[model samples]
Target: MSDATSLLTVLVTSPRLPAGLMSRDAWTALEAAERVLASDLEDPLPAAIEVSGITVTALPYDSPAEAARALVDATRSGSVLWVGSPDADPGLTDALAEELTRLDEPPQIEVLVGSWDLPGARLLDAVAVMDALRSPGGCPWDAEQTHESLAKYLLEEAHETVEAIETGDTEHVAEELGDVLLQVLFHARIAADEDPGFDIDDVAGALVEKLIRRHPHVFGDGDASTPDEVERSWEQIKATEKADRDEDDLLAGIPVSLSPLLIAEKVLTRAARRDIQLTYDDKADLGTRLLALVAEARAAGTSADAALRAVLRQIARPATD
Candidate 1:
């Protein structure tokens, strides 16, 4: 077909986009390829009318079928049939997908974009962007960040995510979650860049696998109704997982990095798990013990927590004297 005939056909075949809603880039690219058609479209396009500068022929179809018919009418042979971003409407996208599956000569070079899994997909994108910015043409800050240098940031972002949740701010939580995602993506990018084996996909897949593996009660046949049942199931799964790795003792999993107070609480929790009489009495007796501790701390001219910590420390490392 001649270039003019082919160009007209291309416009006819192109999807009838919403009037005045098309992106500037899309219009510009169309005009660059076929200026006459773009100009015709630009004149009447209600929403994107200002894009008359875009110089594209606009299809006057109230319906998509009419738009598709225009495509058939305008074209005789090979031409570019620019479909707008296919992933725009869920229903329309499904119909288009079904139509594509039925097409005899489906448009080659047609690209797909976007997905339901946006957050995960964005992480993948971020890893790629991070790598790009750290490579030869990459940003200096990103290029200079080692795993160690970024550790504090990763930890901070995670804490921010927790704080957002604690504050019950949905918007802040969303943004903070993104910050956490950034750190995760950055680390994955660094890993892939340094080792060539680890990437954002691997990081995500590992987390997905771990969650599914751990939640056998949810994902598998085992059903748990209560929180206690859920916890029991989780511990059972955890024990099985640890046993597979030849690690025993649930308490042994606690990190040494835990602060002394936190470690004490955790240790006491584990001890309480044994049903031992560490607390010497009931709720009343427990309050009495706590009051006694407060009195002892007061006698030492210090706060209860501080006084306990001081006594624990002295006993922990008794001086040679």
Candidate 2:
């Protein structure tokens, strides 16, 4: 049996602030700690805890070995050491454990979580649940889903999300958005099964890279004061990025799978960008006339596809008394 005086309890807490966000147990631990240590000297956690009259010490160590040595020395005085956000340096805890084991009278190490994760932090839990559902010995339906098989669901969820937004129902919009996000997660999980598989992190990293690349005004040396200038800059950047891919044809990048109206609008916009005028004679077919209307809608700054969808929705509404 270990003596109470020889034991060292390290309270690990999250660094997120707004003191009310911390748990009561975390607050109690902070209040009781003889010495609080953090890896980052400039981190706001130390200042936040100091607001309540508790002094926090910054661990003067650059590496795991140094940190472990410092922690061991501090704990020899029978002082409870509080480690803020050990997740930042997980190796430090392991090193500390290893170092403690070598000592003949090793202090009884106790790890206590001082703070709980916030609400939005549970998004990671969603990803974990998805992984489990797609893993072997998991749900039959989830395991069978592929990018091709889930395409229809993605389209349906996107339409449902649009409808929820149009209806001005915040709760319904949130639920529909979640469904749309589920489709993204599902597709990413499916891709993870392939030999050269990529996960959601790859998806997110690509998106972040694209966003930064496209928004040169925000991330780089490009200048764009107005929204129109921003849009122009974005298109210019995109054109440069896709220069290797069918650069000869402006419409080459347009997806063939897009709806007829969107395809028409895209074709017209691409042609107009190249200063190629399109005109339909009186002898032109109905398809030509439809394309002319799509061009007209684009000139009026309206989405031809969205305009048709709105009209279709109006026509399909149920009759009222």
Candidate 3:
């Protein structure tokens, strides 16, 4: 077999494109091929290529080995085997390689990437999925959910994400983070249905704006050399952003929706940062003792909320078992 007869070119491409969306190089390869082959005849891509005046032959072989054998035979005549979207069909390439290596004159394989997925494109897919779930004639549970109803899930997912990170399991962390992202998408979708509503784009836009506004050192001329300086800048920026709200008390913005332990810790931490000394009565009850313990935990650089959660988990495990 001569060098011209020993060649096989596999064109890998995304199946999501229309006829004109394909690259010029991909069109050229398809037009120039002596024999174009695809695993699935029913796929729109083969018919689309045929519309451009290229004959695409769907391989009649049932197995990968059989297809490989046919490809080897076709390439023996020095014909170009234009494999359509081989990336979509796994194990086919390996089978072709196995059959090709067995022959004394193997075809030189070429893998062509005709198209690529854009960065963060999957996020659009997630938003679409959420919108579909909440649309009319969609999931009843999802359609009925409101921001108020989904509040618990948002809190739960955030805690689960933190727990996953603490476990140091990358897979679990990714799964939990995806769950958190779903909550964001779900809320945005719900909001989109309301009067004067906003979608995921609005949510993303607001977030981008907030990040840029807070990160003056990176995005602006502000110079924050240390982590502490950056944090101080962030707090100052946040305070200015919230200045329009009528919040006279320093702890007025602290969320009452948080758990008692968390609220206690946050209040104590804020007081400490502001140099506000809190005094507890010695004759006070268990509640005062617990508050004092939270202050002590803060002073020792430990999370009172986390400490309580650990104890609660220990107590709950036995009952769950």
Candidate 4:
């Protein structure tokens, strides 16, 4: 009978990343093991391991139980490493546990993480799914969609996100935000097909550049301690970037199709940024009074658009009667 005090190292790796891209600790474990075993010879990890001149034995077993027993038996000789499958070697861990329970003194098992998914790694999956949907054999609706056709959805998703936020349902807000993100991805994909040179990467790169350029306090040596100071700095940097455009047109880029309240808010903000004092009559028309109210909301550090939405939501609630 072989010794039962041997070591069994189960190595796990993130499928999202490249197969050979393992941590130093994981590589050390792999090198230290007397024997390496894998269930599949065709797996990327096993192939990658073999490239490094480490001989990997592919287990010829009918079930996970049989595989677990074989691996445990191998460990009796010396330290063994098991290369986990991409699907996390389903049922293998439990099977190993059950097999070990039957042993008088089972081999000590250690799970080693070979690789980890970085932040925003799942975004690659989203891009892949979107690409498939827009491809030749994928969804008919998605394939037929254009930027112009999907324009309404962008607005709808944005409104739904706002509504979800107002409702204070975190899950609903997340779902709605996902919808908004889908619009962005969809448009980017459409642009890739139509424009040929631009894609989601371009959009992301431009956004990153803009963010770094605007937030001088965070990314540069410029000073901006408070929120107001940051806002002013951002506007100053933005104005400098757009210095080629008409300097007199403070509201040039503000979308005219936005709601009157939103437009008023943006107009007032631009005017304040440019030090242009906007005068309003105390006893003015309804529109002028509403604009003044927007200005007042801005001064109070609240959003006029969000306040009206909250009130409208309360009024639109189901009748108790």
- Tens digit of lDDT per residue, candidate 1, span 108-226? 32332211342434444566667788788778898788789998898788767865775578999999988887787777777876744687778778889989987777788888888
Q: Which candidate is the best by lDDT?
A: 4
* Model 2: per-residue Cα lDDT over 1-321, one tens digit each: 334465455666554434335667767766666677776645556666667687777776777878887777777775665555535575877888888888777766677776767776657767888999999888999998888999999999998898788768999999999999899989999988887899999998899999999988889988898986787787778889877877557568787777888888877766765678778866799998888888889889998888877788788996688
Off by over 4 Å in 1: 1-82, 85-121, 244-251, 259-277, 280-321
What's the lDDT of the predicted structure labeled candidate 2?
0.76
The TM-score obtained by model 4 is 0.88
Clashes of 4: 0
Which 10 successive residues of model 2 have the least lDDT summed?
Answer: 12-21
Model 3: per-residue Cα lDDT over 255-303, one tens digit each: 8777787788877755655678889886899999889988888888887
Of 1 and 2, the candidate ahead on TM-score is 2
Global Cα lDDT for candidate 3 = 0.78
Worst 10-residue stretch by lDDT in candidate 1? 8-17
Query: All candidates' TM-scores?
Result: 0.50, 0.62, 0.72, 0.88
The Cα RMSD of model 4 versus the native structure comes to 2.6
Cα displacement (Å) at residue 288, model 1: 13
lDDT (Cα atoms) of all candidates against the true structure? 0.54, 0.76, 0.78, 0.89
Candidate 4 regions off by >4 Å?
Answer: 60-70, 102-104, 318-321
lDDT of 3 at 222: 92
